[model samples]
Target: MNRFAWLDAFLGRLIAEDMAVREVPEASGLAPARGISVGADDWGNFGKSARNWNCRWAGCWAEDLGDQLRVHACFEKDHGYLLAHTDLRRATPILSSHAPYFPAAARAERHLQDLYGIAFGDHPDPRPWIRHQAWKNGEYPLRLDFPLAGNPLPATPADQGYPFQHIQGSGVCEIPVGPVHAGIIEPGHFRFHAVGETVLLLEERLGYVHKGIEKLAETRDAHGLARLAARVSGDTTVAHTWAACMAMEKAAGIAVPERALALRAIMAERERIANHLGDIGGICNDVSFSFGFYQFNRLRELWQRTSATAFGHRLLMDRIVPGGVTTDLSETAARAQIDQISTFRPQLGRLMDILNTSPTVENRLIGTGVLAPQAAAAYGALGYVGRASGVDLDVRRDSPYAPYHTLKIPVPIEQAGDVAARVRVRAAEISASFAMLEQLIGGLVPGPVCAPWTPAPPDACGFGLVEGWRGETLAFVRFGTAGRIARYFPRDPSMINWPLLEVLIADNIVPDFPVCNKSVNGSYSGNDL
Candidate 1:
């Protein structure tokens, strides 16, 4: 199917129909996006048009200008991106919501309402999202006048009066899980309504770990923002840092060296492989398969140790700077990387084979936590979660950037949207990442690792899209006067994927929640921020 053909046809329709839309220069990036500015009144119509054209909603964010709030919506189809934005007056901060057209926009709109105090008119659920009594109802934290340190914490608990959905029926009881748990994990509250043992409905309450990441990004220099982006989600530090740098580099018109791009790909692939290994083991551990858990963790620990020796950090934090990577790869490190791949590849194959043939693991994983293809598409799920549900969307292949465009990247997909299917997808991706790493490392070009630093023009806008281990990761950067960061937004794939867990958990037994949750494994820290 020509997924993006409708984009051109839609533009033509806009021109012919004389809709209140105007084309504008795209935000700077490797690929030029179709940018359009829409009036606040026409925002919902714009989203409807895109939905009719079969466009997928990527993400939405709002930036607080001095007197107005600019809301941005991103859509993607067939490797193409269209950015549509609308501005609302600060005093009257109300605009039509896109939630009616795009279900994924609901949380994003609520997020804007919480931070920017922008009311989304006609929104289905207007409850506070990221604001768990951190601030008052009228005090917007993202505004320019708001203090960076923010208001003092209240003496009372923040989530005291929050409302959760209630189901009233015979034999239906609610089970409230934790904002804290016995095992080490991020904080989130999950409410499950079940009859007998089958889950009837599941509602999630997040934002316990909100650290004011977006508010802290304002006015930061290039290096400072880079450091902050790396911590947006520690597990995805390499990806987030790379994305922030890509946005800054594009805005400044600085081209990263070929060698640096290749090295970046190598590190990214390593990150993907390490995380997948850990996840595979975690899923098995949830099913009481301790052998798989211990073995996989053993491999992951060794993998991180090698990464530390090669890149000065186990998680590869601070490895990526504004222009390019922080340091160059040496001969010994490259050889060690290749050697590690060779050594672990066989062990992984053996373990996977044992898992595939084991009746116990197969019984626990297969047909568990099945997410329908329609539901997956509706939520715009990503990474292994979407791929397992047959949504063949990968930023590497769909919207290639830098070294990825030059390499042949294979995206593995599965039709079964179950725990087993997700595991299979991760194993396949690890294999694919191994192959890509070999290509990236073997074809190391001779050039500078980092590019020259130059200030971007004032008011310049740039977008960065990278397929992180979890899925399509996006970073948007706008520069103020003298190259100061006016606003920075990083959309982790978790933000979209976490909500789908609630939808997929229904009709399953409560005992299977652990494995099902692990199968989707949405990062609470990533989603909350």
Candidate 2:
């Protein structure tokens, strides 16, 4: 279906199901499609949309009446039902069946259950998703009524009798790897049941870094909330900040200047290139390719230095604001930097050729951590992981937001679904992003970078989605009369992708864990938040 027509049909389906539909223009000047009003509560307004083709149209439901609980769904746009607030609260048997429809929804529902003490009656896997035994059965820390200061901390949940499915056979043995590891990475435990050299089953225990980011957002204004979003994951600061600001501008009906949109796109592409470069090197390092590792790491450092000089932060934190960008591009500096990238191109090409021909590297990565196309779909994986498995979905290309529509995005996909494929995808994406950067700089326009945004009216709701380096990042925000945030939900791609680690690790040997883990590379900090 064509874009506009498809949106109309989708909206018709929602309207038939009793949702109040509204066609709203792009408030942040990004020009997404229609926004439908889902409902409203004392906390603020609620809404939904299928703004981008690759994106799921999710329900943004919030309640500020007392507990200030915010609940939402991030299901596929074409294949899910919208459950009304009244229907959700009928005390009817909680339907646990939604997970089967959208696997991403499973993690989100579990998060709601943990923070709001709401029951997902029939939730297929209701096994205490994010509630890590810090609170009792009746306590919900996210509730507004819950004391913000000096709340008694509950004891950690006891580990005695906690159940994990075991795989058994004549030669099977279990190997456990950390909720704490040797690396500086965040905590998560992986259990592998292996028979000789092959793995029979894999299970993961996460949630070691949950900091109640959503709950904290309730107490901050837009700027404060932006800071919180930037901290969702250090590596994904630009993406998170952009999503937060997009939501804020939408809520306030603020239109950012065209120049600001261009600058945001430039930073986003740089972020993508930087991350891909680092990951490529890290993946090589895992496989003992010291030469490749050193070269790629050096390149990555160069890219980061460029970002630090251009954006004032190596990771570009706080570079995005509600009405546009926090900084403007320096044409003279950008031109000089483009020259550096041009010089680095041949070096990157030589390194790619060397890595592609390295037999040892190829042997380890070619058939490891394979995620079949169907399995990837069932898990709802995104970003490089999904692309490697043949999903072929990229939010920038499929959604065409901002500068992406003006400059068509090229999506690179592979069917291997293995470590090698992921590495290749990253390599190709880095090249593509560099090309995009060149084009963006060449077409640089001059104008105001930010538009002034007044505070949003009380009870206004907004939703924002950005194609982060990892995948699609989404934020739902609601504002109060006093210009403070009433409710906020930021859904990171890690939340959906992390669960797939368990599925993909099955049947692989314990020795291959490093390559497998690097292939998925789900962000623990992002998920825990």
Candidate 3:
């Protein structure tokens, strides 16, 4: 079907199904699609960007559907958003089930269930998503009435009796890892049931670091909300902050200065490079290559320190504000930095050669934890993971924004979805980002770095999507009267990528978990939010 025709048909389906639908002009994007409007609790009229022919609906209650929730389905271009809202008033109190239609929605639904005291009826696998053992069963912190101070007394732990399907055979053994680890990483439990060394089944139990970020955002103003967004993942601070600011400005009908937009892009690319370098080294370290690890790590540290010197923060936190950026790069500073990057290129090339030629490194990573193209698409994986699996979707290229439009982004892709493929993708991306940075610095123009923006009108909604280091980082913002935040939803790519880990780990030996994990490298804090 044609684009507009397909959208109309989709809208028709929603309206026919008794769902509320509205076409919002301000929040609308390119033609042939519609913007759906929804009420923001603190921020007034928040609208979502949709095809000119999209549908908008209100609160929904979940219903059980065996192993998954079959609550509500809203279609997008490549994937759909299925939501399950549990009715807390019911006596039997069955959670509304959904997310079977879209694997990406599974993590979000699980989070809703955990925070809102809602249940996903017949969810395929209903483990405690965001609920840590810190609170009691009767305590639902996300509810509008839930106190922010938290309960004084410790609540009994929720029933921990999840029935994991077990595999039994000769030479079979169970391997449990984490919830506590040797490193400083966040806590997550992974249970691998294996026959000899080969993994038969893998079960993941996360939520050890649920920070209630969403709940916190629900109470703050736009500025306060942006601060919280930046903390979603420390490494991706610049990307997340930019997304939140973009969403707020869009909702407020504010246009950012061209120079500010350029600066934002530069910061984002720098952040991306810093992370890619670290991860490339980290993946090598996982396979016991300390030389590559130390060298790449040193490079990453140098890059981060450069960013700190330029932006006043190593991760560039708070550099993005609604309608603009917080600082500008002087011509002299830009030139010096660009020259430094040029000098660092040869050293990076040498490290790359060392890693590429190592037989031991290549052997462990080449065919380990293969995620086929189809599985990658189904999981809605993004960034390096998706690229490695042949899903060539980059927000910067496909959905161009800001300086990215002026500077063409060449996304690197690979057919192999193994650890080695992930490493190669990161390496390629780092090179591309450095090239783009040089161009941006060369083209830097002296102008105002920020524009003044008034608060958004009551009941305005806006959505922002940025290509972060991990993947596509999405932020939905709604503004209420008096400039308060109405509702904020920041969806990290980790939320979608983490589940793919389970699928990819299958049939692979238990010993390769670290290598496979480093390839994906999902943030536990980001996902727990």
Best by TM-score: 1
RMSD of 3: 6.0
Query: If candidate 1 were superposed on the true structure by all CA atoms, what would the RMSD be?
Result: 1.5
Between prediction 1 and prediction 3, the one with superior TM-score is: 1
Q: Tens-digit lDDT track for model 3 on 1-529?
A: 2423454565565556444554345333111223442221100111122222332121122222223332222233532222212113433334434354456656676776766655666566677666766676667666656676777455546436655567787787888788897676778888899887888888887887778787677648877887898898898898899989988887787888888988898899999998889888888888888888898999988888888878788889988887788888876668767987887788878888878788998898889999899888766678899999998878787667888888878999999998889888998898889898988887877789888878877767666778899988777666667888756767788877887899999899887888898889998888776
* Clash pairs, model 2 backbone: 43-64, 67-144, 94-121, 94-122, 96-122, 96-123
The lDDT for every candidate, in the order shown, is: 0.88, 0.73, 0.72
Kindly list the per-residue Cα lDDT of model 1 for residues 1-529, writing each as its tens digit: 4545667678877657656788776545524567788888878777878888778898999888777889999998776888888888988989888898888888888989998888888999999988887788888888889998777675736477678889998999999998996578888998999999999999989989999988888888888999999999999998988889988888889999988898888889889989999999999999999999999999999999989988889999999998889878889999999999999899999999999999999999999999988999988889999999999989888778889988888888898899999999999999999889888989898889998788888877788889999999999998888878989999999988988989889999999999999899888888888
Least well predicted 10-residue stretch by lDDT in candidate 2: 40-49
Worst 10 residues of 3 by lDDT: 38-47
Report the number of the highest-lDDT candidate. 1
Candidate 1: regions farther than 4 A off: 1-5, 15-18, 26-30, 154-156
Of models 2 and 3, which has the larger TM-score? 2
Q: Write the per-residue lDDT of candidate 2 for residues 1-529, one digit (tens) a residue.
A: 3445555666676567565544445343223534333433211112223322344433323354552233444434432222223223423213233454455566666776766666666566777766666666667777667765425456555443446778767888988888888666678777788888888888877777888787788858888988999999988888888888888888888888888888888888888888888888888888989898899989989888888888788888888877888888797668766986797788888999999899999988888999898878766678899899998677787766678888868888999899899989888888888888888888888999989868887877776778898987877787876889988878788887887777778788787888788878888888878
